[model samples]
Target: MTTNLTQHFLLDPEVVFLNHGSFGACPRPVFEDYQRWQLKLERQPVEFLDSRRGLAANLRVARTALAAELGTDADSLAQVTNATTGLNIALQSLPLKPGDEILTTNHEYSALEKTLLFIARRTGAKIVTVEIALPLNSAEAFHDAVLAGFTDRTRLLFLSHITSPTALLFPIERLVAEARQRGIWSVIDGAHTPGHIPLDLDALGADFYSGNCHKWLMSPKGSAFLHVRPEWQAMIDPLVISHGWTADNKEPGVRGPFGASAFVDEVEMQGTRDPSPWLAVPSALAFRRDHDWWQVAAECSRLAQETAARVRDLFGLPALSAPSLSAPQMVAMPIPPCDPIAVHDALLRDYGIEIPVFEWQGHHIARLSCQGYNTREQMDLLVKALGELLGLEQPRRKLGQA
Candidate 1:
């Protein structure tokens, strides 16, 4: 059933689209809904943008629905273009002093690493990274690995809920608790968590968390949210100074610390932009809900597990991070010694397979993702392609079919 779901997506029919981890493909219905909001905006620009109450109400509805799913309140959230922007706001907003260290993992997204580096260089703070061992067995090992890097200079602990390069789900809950006990700010880059996995943001209890709706949530591009805890919300500054910026914290008395009105006024009241994608969040949620997304994601996760096993067996390489419990729907495996760019070119040129193959930690890593639209046959083809490229006979591993 999930394999048949390809008809709903606008992906190229000829290519085996396995790189859902990169830029996610939006389903037709959700894309239509995104366009509908854009059309509505175009119909009456002034009236739509000036209607503060109407816009706020629309955002409230969308955030309320999303918050219910994410296990957080609408008051704690603000819309952003993507997780990168949200993280930029968070990293820039915090009032860090010189010599304050922001600790993170080596598995972080490269873009985020650059952002943090810039912040550190600008503010005299330091970016400290800890290494996570491959073939990870348990969450405890991950937590221990990060905790081992903790020191007195570490003011904040930054990490991904689901890492980008390696595709491992960290033990964030325990890490957050550990950070809290040590008076460290816990910031999570949750760009891949919302729709792929079950998220309980309130229970997770991180000081700050940002994620992309455009990725796992299957929303149109440019839809994401930044969630700040009560204590940290007042400190958050908008990346751009606009109408929302004022001498006074507007409506601070009525709107608690980070309630929807205050948070929106501070972070969301930026000058001008198409707010359509964020408004279309409900449509994206509905698209998945109508399709029994939980079961679909579960089915895809099984295929992802099988794909990882197949790739590892084909390459004679160990899994990068996933071992006991496989990454849900996305996995990164190490390939044999080869030029990553050449392999990337060959995969796209010879094979009509769209996947990410890159260098990480001096190893050529290829991350494979299986969405609801992906099929087992496509995964088999990927295995065959890898075997032929690497000059090995494809060994049929005793893998359980998803």
Candidate 2:
């Protein structure tokens, strides 16, 4: 935390970036590693792609690093382009009968919700949505909302590990356990989870989970992974059928260090494309270790908590979650009722700050992400800009002036 780590990243110096959750900003060294891999591929397309050894080794190394960091078996996980791609693959492979219900919370990422809808349309599956009340205080509040939507027809539970809109980390471990007791499949969207918080995919025990390395792990874009529990791996197919379709499905130890399961081989054996982003995950893990990540995470957490409290008070809006239940590095704080699009544009153009402003479930909110590169000065600038746009005095300065 002592180092001014902004020098390592490749962000626009003129703009204050507060939206790390959307698309992560990669560091110079990691970006260089990515470019190096891409250039190597271009130089000898046949040598890189045809040999299969290099790509296979890179995939093993990346998955090994991720497995160590995320607490799951390496073979059970396979790299994908992004979380959305992974979700589509999983949803498509499911055996949904007519009128079977796929239950999910309202706070999920919109695109994935649309994916579920696509699946519903293709099959005769029905979608059941649970409305979780805001100003949630504990894990019990989350548990209640989810169970309220369950019925005899509920066959699968799709929920976010960390929701995109509300930014609250759901208490999924117990829910997954309860679903297992009743023979239900749990599909989790964990796009925001990798480096935002500690991950233990095995312990969570969801039947399916998809997470993005590009968002929080500081990897290149187009890097993510889908993890299927061993029981479900055989049934899940590749999004695109390539050479792997003919490959042996039950061969044990066919691949290298991480090796090929029918799952890993089928999903990863697609034809030629740039694999630099997935390959660069090892470098991203190394970068995280070289810097003191614990301290960096702590600093970001403190800043996030302070920003959330101040913003919520400014608008007289309630906290969407308890501090521990909310993410340490990101918070979806409610702003006073105003045109969020206007405020968003003015902040970027007039104040040179980059962040996200969106409407979620009929409320306008701003989600802020504090990274190692950010400082209190940048936060103060954001607070000032928001105050002027909202036509109010500085919220932090006028704490007790009621």
The model with the greatest lDDT is: 2
Query: After aligning candidate 1 to the native by TM-score, how far in Å is the CA of 369 from where it should be?
Result: 0.6
lDDT of 2 by residue, 1-402 (tens): 344589999999999999999998898899999999999999988778753547677777888888888899888888999999998888899999998999998888999989999999999999999988887788998898898888999999999999899889888889999888889999999999999888899998999999999988999999999998887876787789885554444443345222467688778878878889988998998999999776798888898889888887767888888997887899998887766776787789888999999888787888999999998888889887777777565532333222
Model 1: residues >4 Å from true position, as ranges?
1-3, 250-253, 256-259, 324-326, 392-402
Per-prediction TM-score, please? 0.93, 0.94
* Clashes within 3 Å, all models in order: 0, 0
Q: Best TM-score goes to which candidate?
A: 2
Q: lDDT for every model?
A: 0.83, 0.85
What lDDT score is found at residue 367 in candidate 2? 93
